[model samples]
Target: MPQLDDGSESVEMSVAMLRRMAEQGVGAVCATSHYYRQQNSIETFCARRADALDRLLVNLPEGLPRILPAAEVAFFSGISEKPDLGRLCIQGTRTLMLEMPFSDWTDLQVEEVSALVLDRGFSVVLVHPERFCSSKGNRQKLRQLEELPVSLQVNAGTLLHWMDRRVGLNLLREAPIPLLGSDCHNLTTRPPNLKEGRKIVIQKLGSAFLDKMDENAADLTRQTANATT
Candidate 1:
């Protein structure tokens, strides 16, 4: 339920957008704005995200899916060692949606994921492996990631051939990609069409795979609630 909003700039989120998302059967969405150290500090990004969430909530129509504040933190060196980085995890959950670098991952980068999982007890959900795992070597690296307690998330638009369809389909067929995100940005560009993605998923992997994905999402939501309480 993580929605990737335009982080570098101000974008309008309307009731129509939420209504469209609701129509797609989305119960809730995490407003995961991009967090890159080069662009802005964590504090500044968080403050902006909070402000945006407050503004959106004030004008939210009745019966629309709730929006939770979060950040899709950009992976960096020594991130696992940064103590305060946990504050950027999805609101109350231990889950962090990590947007991996476009280049091939280094050993230290891979080790950071392990540290985040085993030492810090965080659920590291890697976003859009299809983008990075374009080669056999990269796919092998993805398999290495699977060996850990990490989860993989694919964008719904990718499945619909909006992005690289071949890579997306390759990951869907081969990888244990459990989470399917709409990665919704705005109403015009990347609209929420999870229903379409779900149909594609069901068509390819069957209803059982969709059921398992739902269970995983529910478990993450439960974990978030428990952490808040």
Candidate 2:
């Protein structure tokens, strides 16, 4: 097993994932496992992630897409105060994939994220902001994030779900750095479907917009990879 986040549980799954992503014409991927601060310390989380990555890399099958290790760290009060918070950033870059709180965000919470970007030297990426859209205050806080350096990532399921599709498109329009995620959990029900979201993006935002999105994604990973390699 790869012991990776989402449903990438085994080498067989990796092979399956390669084919699945190929269908979407995706050439590279970020293995962003979840990091729950309540359950583990930074050292513990990194150790586990390293072990899983080692296991996966050792037995990796041929033709697998490039994998960049990262964590989707859940937000908590005073998280920016944690000295090791930078350890959670994506490998080779100071970009943190922040999973914003599901409940209404407070000024303190938003300020902490600001501190991360403005003070702590981190480029924060908010994962699946559409999930928090129902709360009016959350929506406003999302806007507040615009003042700071941040990226908004919408899930593929957002466009896949009819109820969320319109709201997701609107959210993308308001995003500072719009990114899309598959958020695939398993082989069935919830699965890799960035292709579906790409279709929606083209319909709503035009193919050129989606091309820029792809270029943005490529540029980010390529820059980081070049920096480290």
Candidate 3:
């Protein structure tokens, strides 16, 4: 648990983190730790994530947001075919959060991500594409990903930051995004700020937009309320 978030201090991070989410009225939180194919097998990563989550659940703060165990898997070749990939989806759902490659994407790379939807039947959510926004080629590639049954997510910090807000807002205008995340890491610095970000969205995009975002979030985590496993 301490190891998952380098600054977490231990399972106490989970306790403190969720309490903050509760204070903010967050109903669900996706605990998506980083997963790199080059460093570990899916089975090993899933087992370790389960153990970390178990430790957190033992003393999870009462009335806090619901936890959805998942991974922000870094993309790689043939990931769609990973036999244990489904195990990494948010527990009780087929939604998967993915961190795309930092380098310029190749057509094959795009095709494999499409395969994740068309062939593998996984609903892939691309994490924080606004951070990677630039270059017409990349935007075109993202548009291609959008053509599939894929969605993009924007970080709350991206909208809240004065410097990044323009880019963040522009993405909202141009991209097919149905998700917004707190992307909270610790109690301070990169702490949960979904409320603050939503405020910006309300001012810029209106309540109707925020309502749609909340609806999409509910749909994505629908089974979480009833999940026993």
Off by over 4 Å in 3: 5-7, 224-229
Extract clashing residue pairs from model 1.
none
How high is the lDDT of residue 34 in model 1?
A: 81
Clashing pairs in 3: none
Better of 1 and 2 by TM-score: 2
Which is the winner by TM-score between candidate 1 and candidate 3? 3
lDDT of 3 by residue, 1-229 (tens): 3457443567887688788888888988888888888888888888888788788888875688888888888998988778868777788888888999888888999988988889877878899998667767788898888878677788989998899998887766665656788878788888889989999999998899889888877777666432321
lDDT of 2 by residue, 117-207 (tens): 8887777889999889889999888899987768888898889889889988887888878888887656677778999899999998999
Question: Which prediction has the highest TM-score against the true structure?
Answer: 3
- Candidate 2 steric clashes: 0
Off by over 4 Å in 2: 4-6, 223-229
Task: Return whichever of 2 and 3 wins on TM-score.
Answer: 3
> For candidate 2, what is the lDDT?
0.80
Q: What are the candidates' C-alpha RMSDs?
A: 3.1, 2.5, 2.6
